[model samples]
Target: MTPEPTLAALLARLDRVEAHQAVADLMSSYINACDLAKDIDRIVEHFTPDAVWEGVGRNIEFGTWQGREAIAANFRGVQERQPFTYHYLTNQEIRVADDALSATGRWLCFEPSTIREGTLPVWIGLAYDNTFVRDGDQWFISHLAVDTLFATPYDKGWGVEMFTPVTAPKEPSHA
Candidate 1:
């Protein structure tokens, strides 16, 4: 015969479940702010004051940004370069610490972006490794490391070319 779970065990399980959901929600909110709202303030609010955002692999050119202000600047640069983007995240795995004060998460991202003043369509594949710290009841990203799998033009695809040529749009003619 099986015994019922103790009240303390049930509460612990509930806390873990809630923590997982909170972390997932935070990621979703961040993506929405970047993709849909394009609100730099909203995006930066997801991170801790001293958070570190770093890009690796094929995206090493992005470099690293530490602190909320730096991260906001990085996002602003991205906004200018890619005016439109849709980010989709999948295969998310989040593990809450036993103490429930911190967590780690991994996600795979597929992003379709329009760049060069909507003249170029590009596809970006990325892997994200993130750490979150809990402050009271709220959680904020402490470190976010993204590795780019590929960033290829839609027409050429990554199989043919690893990345699309990034060029500024031609200026309007004054005649």
Candidate 2:
């Protein structure tokens, strides 16, 4: 015979589920604001006051921005460079803490952009490792690390060279 769950256990399970869903929704909202909504204010609202946003590697613009103002500037730069952008996220992995106060996620992104005042469209492949914090029942992005794997014109796909990291060893690995 199985025993029913205690009220405390049931509430704890619910809290975890709610936190996970909230974090997922937060991610979707930020991405939609960046592309579909194209609302800078909405994008800014997703981050914590002391959030940090950083980009690594050669595939995309690289910068380390801290605080809400700096993060807003980064998004503004994106808007300036691309009049219209579409971002697709896949392979998402999200983990919420047992206490339901924080979470982390990893995602792969394919972004295509219409360059401002230009006819050419560019595409980029990126990986996002993000962290979220729960503040008074609301979740906000606390850190965003974006690693761009490849960035090229729509007509030109990534080649072998794109797959090779700039800092690779001189000799091939045996493994």
Index of the highest-lDDT prediction: 1
The deviation in Å at residue 68 for candidate 2 is 1.0
Residues 126-161 of candidate 1: C-alpha lDDT, one tens digit per residue: 899999999999999999998878789999998898
Please report, in order, the local distance difference test score of every candidate based on alpha carbons. Answer: 0.86, 0.78
Candidate 1 residue pairs that clash: none
Look at candidate 2 and tell me the lDDT of residue 88.
94
For residue 115, model 1's alpha carbon misses the true position, in angstroms, by 3.2
Q: Using alpha carbons, what is the TM-score of model 1? A: 0.88
Which residue runs does candidate 1 get wrong by more than 4 Å?
A: 1-4, 116-118, 165-175
